[model samples]
Target chain A: MTSSGGLRGYFVRSENARGFSLLAPTLILLVLMMVIPIIMLVARSFWTQSGMIETADFSLVNYQMFFEKKIYLYVLGKSLLISGSVTFATLILAYPAAYFVAFRVKKNKLIWLILITVPFWTSYLLRVFAWKLMLGYNGVVNSGLIGIGIIDEPLGFLLHNVNAVVLTLAHAWAAFAILPIYVSLEKIDKSLLEAAADLGEGPIRSFLRVTLPLSMPGVIAASLLVFIPTVGDYVTPKLVGGSSGIMIGNLVTNMFGRGNNWPMGSAIAVMMMISITLVVCIYLWLISQVKKRSN
Target chain B: MTTVAIDIRGVSKVYNPGSNQAVQALDTVSLTINDNEFFTLLGPSGCGKTTLLRLIAGFEQVTGGEIMLFDEEIENLEPSQRPVNTVFQHYALFPHMTVAQNVAFGLERLKKPQAEIDATVERVLSLVKMKELGDRRPNQLSGGQQQRVALARALAPSPKVLLLDEPLSALDLKLRQNMREELKQLQRETGITFVFVTHDQEEALAMSDRIAVMSNGEVQQIGAPTDIYEHPVNRFVADFIGDTNFLDGEITSVNDDLVTCRVGSESLFEAANSGNHSVGDQVTLFLRPEKITLSAAGDASRQGRVANIVYLGNQAAYTVDMGDGIELTAQARPREDGNLPFATNDTISVDYSARALRVLAK
Candidate 1:
């Protein structure tokens, strides 16, 4: 009885046991909602689909086909290039807006931050469609320019290409890039700028040496936040990406829906996730290396 | 002849510190600090001592007057353009940079060669005695160590003038005392004109070759530590610098620099005077507590019963209640055998030299 009670007490009274109990509900929900699906997806990746029937035997046939096809690799590389551009474009656009909120807007900072997030309030699909209206062949930009007599004809380059995908994704994920950078900039000591000036640095040089480097953490976070999600975004690419902007996500969707290849889709999906994870790890390592030398 | 390091001529600043609509923070304040001298702007918070310092440092523009650094106009120059650096109140060391990096920042900004920059950084770091911790970031070091790095960083460029804004206020009492001597020694060793701003009168007295006591956006008095402590020109300076007994009185008679005052019928009489004040002019007599000696009531100028006795280590303070609503505080060292001179409720004589008291125009 003592031994049994001792074992029960360990489960009930230990720090680890108490902590686990606190997170028990969240853990259970996460396993049910996320972990089980991911495990099933991995399992399906090793299966073979044969004409309206999926054979559940373990096989690498889908993987072998993915490697055999060069289109998948090309699309994946294009997706990476597009996502990288999106991250860069969003960062450059967001940095100044975030700086204005963090430094210039002494009053009503909350209003400024909320205004940044206002564009993202609508449904994601609608926002992508809105970008469609703005950048379409007979879009607002092209039509407005034509009406102003600035151009002779509608610019076909305005829509349905890699540029359209990049512009739309960058605009969609702008708030994520801005808020973190704003927080980092706001956390910097204002007196450091004054000290920098006192130490004989011009306004521009002071900002480059002190303000830019100090706000790197937020910059890195913003980059990853924009890059990771936009890499696999299919809706924006499908609506605007005609040929050149097609990404890995579109390929996976095709295999699952029209192509009738669930195993191939799973395999492609798993590979995309692995690729994003690998890129993020490398980016973080490079950022750390740069930071180490800054000191 | 000594050269003037900073010639602040009628430099008035009108600034709104966000709390109020607009405060004339510095009012036509003029001062001349000599080269290589440690000058202090001593005042309580919001008294415009810091405003003057900031104006001199080129952080703010003067509304009315010009400031000359080494006899060259600098009010229009940017804070960066001025050849001066500040040791900020909070140090403001870059949180990301290591100690060595922070020290090298100023040198590197001047476009000095890499070897010269490295050597200067090394020398200043060791001068502040933070040689081994140069690799540690500001956040990793203790407050005192960060203070040394801030000092080293400000000193690295060897600016003509170094403005220190209460850089020792954040440290504990013991550490603060140690830093005070070290900072003074640094000023001597570097021979740089040090402009120190602080509210602590003792720190100013101990460190500054000359102190400018400020009040209500004006320079109340500017003199050496001894002159400021001993012969304050106005009531504000006398009251703000130390503990003193202020007795409102009318000037009864004037004799050169000595004026006799009538306080509550019994004119307890002549005190040192400043400026021109005719007889019957309203004035105040201030006597330092330490200047007064306590003894048992005898044939004396005035007598009061001791109302309270506060036992301080090595000394005691006696609150004496004289007639006509007048009370006086006198501090006395304990008797040679380690006992107080008198207990509470005992009548005592308040004895002070006429030279030890001063009269200020009300």
Candidate 2:
């Protein structure tokens, strides 16, 4: 029975072929939902507007508009700065909390993680609106401050500003930052920490040398999860942000909704995607370089 | 220059306070390790051997009792503050570090000079025979190489005591055997007191200067390998250390030096230097398998039939069924002539001297 190697090999190949055929439908659906739209967006970026159909007059006019317009440049720069700040702040704040959750809190871990994720279950619009109310001129924050007698008057700079956008975005995306970092921290073997301790590292030294370096993957993941989405978010900026808080996402929305320029919107969307992709690639490359050097 | 390296007294640990289901991991364990001796805690799983090691390492606190290292009270010290290092079961080499960096990590933490740290790392790496592989990451090395790197890292700081928690359990059988000798040599060369924990009896017997056989959160016996093998305190220790043939019987006659026990119908057995026992007392006689010899012709002493024959490479082991239905094993070296002296279903005489059996009081 074991002598039929040729037949067995053919059977295995056919079985793998059957498996691939079974996966064809999901692959087709993914291509339709994700790949097709990306290709269409890139194609639309090179075209001129012609009512409902795109004209064949391909030019660098959209690219020139993006670089030449000072408003677009300012918004793009602000968006990058805000997203970068949020990423750094989230990483710094989330790391210790994640380390505690992973190594210190040995009991009720799932319960605590669920509690961390509870804010995300509520409607995003409602949460943003609540932030708006809290940051308003006569909102609860200003009222509480005045009641406490710390600030004599309501600070009008609290709402409709870049600070509000950053604060609200940080609050909104905290769970995103915490979960990945917590997972990465959790995946570190306890024996590794014990080994570090055995090697004469105090708790602080162990954290800096072992825990911090090992959790860089999670930090990068959390950074991308927050920064990539926040760079293109318009809701928080529109609600809590005044004229000074306009971001690249707001411009992209305006070009698509009120500006009635789908080609320009697609061009801006492509640019944003390219910039974020480039930044993420550079970050990953730098991290890999550091890892290589350490090893 | 032999000084007391570690002095542990009345150490016990209980997890989950105020609960009836609490687990007593360690129970008032006390032992003093000499400065340069290799002491091993040998026991089965859940026997509190690892717990005792961890308590001495200051990774776990004792509920009651004290531990002294280098004649100083260190029971309350954190693991980092203790003058000890541990080689974990998995080696736990920092995946982010090269072999040289991992070895130098402890020295760097001690704030040693760069020249000294480099020299010590190189010396220790060379001691472990891993100097050439310093640039390789832990994942790039084999299991034995990684284990050596871990040992180098642990010893680079010149800790007072090196605690090993089943460091060889993860290696393959051949590598484990090879590393065992390397570990012993390393300990001897470094002159650091080593407290090793292992469940493998062979490993414990081979490496330890003194083996503490533990069971049920308590030390059953602590002695040299030969003493532990020849004289076990209880049935658990006797059975755990090696294979032993036990015969349950009643002591018919007892004296200061010897005891005559009635093993079966019409069979009288003499045990030499048997422990304190009274007449008509129920007792058990323990005999090692290799001590008994099998002869084809019935001897006047003990008689049985060959029930089974197992031909090992260097020796032949036979299970003889006595007339009373008790099966006993007798081992003999295979002769070079290949002449078979014993066969299945053949009547055989199982003979052993009075000194071969150890009489244990019930």
Candidate 3:
């Protein structure tokens, strides 16, 4: 009973103990929802899938299938390529927007931030469907082109391709890229720019030498945030991607839903996670190298 | 012939112009800083010294009049285009760059040869005695180290003039004093004009070849350190430079340069008249505390009882009530035994030379 009272005193006195207790509910929920599901998936990836009955017997057959199938390799590569382009496109679009909002817009900054995240309030599925309508045959772009007499016929190439997937994905993940980059840009000391200018660096050179390099952490974080989820995303591809834009996520979805191959789906998911972690690690290492070399 | 490095003519700056909240920061201020000279702009905070410095650096634009750098009009130029560099008060060293990179920044911006940039960066870093800490970032070093890096960075391009905006204000006393000596020596060695701004009068007096005393967006006086301290034209200049007692009185008799002033209702004191003042003219006389000598009892004419004694090392300040409600502060050196001579309520005689008690017009 004395020990129990002492433990209570420790809980009350120690900030770390109290902090962990405050985080306990969220931690337990994450363990149940995410960690246990990932563990189950790993276990299922090692099991054998025979026709309709997936057995508890551990084997490398599911992993072997991933290498043996050419379709899986093609789709996985295409998915990675699409996500990579999406990440690149979003960064290019987001940087200037974030810079403009951070440096140029002095007043009503909250309004600008609210505008960036406003798109999130609507349904993600609805937005993807909206992109489909915009990119589809006889859609806004096609009709507008026809009305302007710019093209003789509807551009079928706009839809049913990797272009549509990249476009939709880039648009969806834009705010994630912008907000972090904005925060980093805003955090930079304004006097550093003045000092650079005083040292004879013009506006363009100052931005490149001082502003660009300093905001790299935000750029890296935004890259990972967009790249990780987009690789496994299937909804935008399903709506606007049509036949050509189907990716690894589509295959995983198919194996789980119609194919009833949970073990195969689990294997593909695990492989995707592993490959992404490897890519992000290399990217982060390269960024750190660049930062150090510049210094 | 002394060439002028910066010739700021009738320049004025009114922040937020044409608005109700417009503040007149500088008003028709004209000053010429000579080349290779250590000139100081000395004033209290918000006294337009910084405004004048910024105008010369092209950081802020002038509402009227022109600024000439080395006899070339440069008021319209951008801060980057101007051939001047600033050592900001806070150092403003780039957090992302090492001390070497920061020092090399200006040379790199000028597109100098990499070899030349390396040599200049090395030279300037060593000049500030920061050669060993080149690889360390600004945050990694102490305040004084960062200050050296800032100075080295500003000097790397060999700017025609260096504008130091109270750079030593961040450091503690000992470091600040050491830096002040280094900076004065640096100016002499480099032969580049340095325009230093500070509120600390002692720093201005110690380092400047010429000091410009300013107040309320206008220059009060411009002269050598001794000229400013000894012969301040008005009450503000005398009070700002150092500690001085203001003895307000009316001139009873004028003797060309010397005037006998009736002070404290009954006492008459002789003072040097700066401006043309006739008999019966009201004048304010400024007497330096150190100029007045204090003794327990002597042939000194003015006698006063000590109201308060403040013990300062090497010197003690005594507030003396010189009869009839006239209180004046005076400083005296410690005795041969290293003890303060006067205590509270002790009557002491005050003696000051007629030349030391100069009068400024009312």
Candidate 4:
């Protein structure tokens, strides 16, 4: 009987092993689709460009070129600045709206959340195109301003500029910012607010100390959601950014699409990924420091 | 010497506007809590005891009347503005904060100097005997420990009135008993006006100097715990406060505070005080379980069959199956002779003095 029991235990362990093995296909697929490509991109960054197949020789020449060329450096700096601005603006706008949705608008919460997410249901490219029309020289915005006599003529700053790209990205990612913030605010126990009030905190103080700090996780998540995608987006800049409005993403796209420099493009892509990872790590570390000091 | 800490005059709360199903949570409730007194609101569920506590805390608005705190009209004041702190039923400690941080939250809000806040937090934590666990987060602590932290947090503010809403209900039985003693000690040490809300009669009796027994959104009776337990004003209060053997009878004779009642064909009972009773009026006499004495020998006033005997540690409780649809319980103290006084299936007589029985108004 003991031997049979041991055999049954062995069978159970084997069943678990079989279950894990069944999951191997999906795991392998994910690695192939995501991890392997990223690894390849990083590896390719070290290779020098050749006629057809890149040179087998590896060097830091591509990275040096990224720094040596003022255009690439400018593009990288502009990309960081633009994405940072978008992130801060999105958070500023989203936090209050999310607080309102979570605390004030109690009923039909799901419906409101769905309404926020409705923009994502339509094609992202279509949304960009719609923004393009709205910001065009003769579009609704320019016409409205001119109609109201705010300006003598249509301003060239609205379309095919950095402002247009930033505006489009902000509109596109507002939903991302709102949802996580709403969820975090919703998870806060109402009694905490009451406790704050009972502890002699006015409405403003309670909001600053309790509500804002507790919702940090959501803010971090929203920041990452906007920053990560905005850093790598070539489409928005390509359509809306004119001559001087080019970013690192557009540079990388040019290397692949027009310049036919795959190795160079992969190098730029790897750098962008590294920069984003470093920024996110620094943000997370800073937040942890703040949390530690507060405690 | 006798400043009223809280004066609630004719307060009521009706929730939900422009709806047919609006509930009158509190109705015309008036109460005066003396300074430094441990007052308890004791009631069953949905009795608006917590609502009353909240109204005093300034967490809820009084629909009609006014609440005064230390001669100040505080019904319109915010919760923060009132010199009151509440220990919530769930002990709602900030989960992200450590015990020390939770305790310091109120002081921080007061914007006291750093040194003062630190000293106060440490003092309160030590008061709750939770100084060692101050560094631990709320989730890391046990339920009893969390309760202490909550108490420390509320007390750290040095509020005049401390409101506890079923604070001990979450603890285990043994822990609850121990915490009750600790809480009483703390209250005595602090000498703050404590307004505790609880549905547990034993807790109310053990803790409070005075208890207000509430039901159906109204205060049925409010008095010292002994009076509330022994001389409950009505049937609901009597039934709610303790275990009582109710004898239904008609008052055959009445004179001032004395009333003679006939229980059945032969048995006659005399209650010392029948409040607002007339001759030939039907009333219920509430005799506590411990008040009745069981004897095997026949008594003139009462007789019954011993239906069951429960052997509790120090005392034996006998359930007498009095025929004519009446049942009574009597307790017998353990004796050195080691002889069982009563047994099941044995006929016995249950007797109590006239003073032991309270005639409750319906």
Q: What is the lDDT of residue A285 in candidate 4?
A: 95
TM-score of each: 0.94, 0.94, 0.96, 0.94
lDDT of 4 by residue, A14-65 (tens): 9787686789999899999999998888888898886676785788888998
Model 1, span B307-326: residue lDDT tens: 98889988988889988778
Residue A269 of candidate 4: its Cα lDDT? 88
Query: What's the C-alpha lDDT at position A182 in model 2?
Result: 97
Superior candidate under DockQ, 2 versus 4: 2
Per-model chain B TM-scores are 0.94, 0.96, 0.98, 0.95
**Clash pairs, model 2 backbone:** none
lDDT measured at residue A44 in model 2 versus the true structure, 0 to 100:
80
Angstrom error of the Cα, residue B188, model 4: value is 2.6
Candidate 4 at B141: error in angstroms?
A: 2.0
lDDT of 3 by residue, B1-362 (tens): 99999998999999999999899999999999999999999999999999999888888899998899999999678899999999998988999889998998888866678998899888998999999999998989999999999999999889999999999999999999999999999999999999999999999999999999999999999999999999888889999999999988899998777899999788888998665788898888889998998887777888999999899898999999998667889998888999888888988899889988888877
- State which candidate, 1 or 2, has the greater DockQ: 1
Give the lDDT of residue B141 in candidate 1. Answer: 94
lDDT at position A125, candidate 1: 98
Question: How would the candidate models be sorted by DockQ, starting from the highest?
Answer: 1, 3, 2, 4
Q: Give the clashing pairs for model 4.
A: none
Error of 1 at A122 (Å): 1.2
As for lDDT, the candidate ahead, 2 or 3, is 3
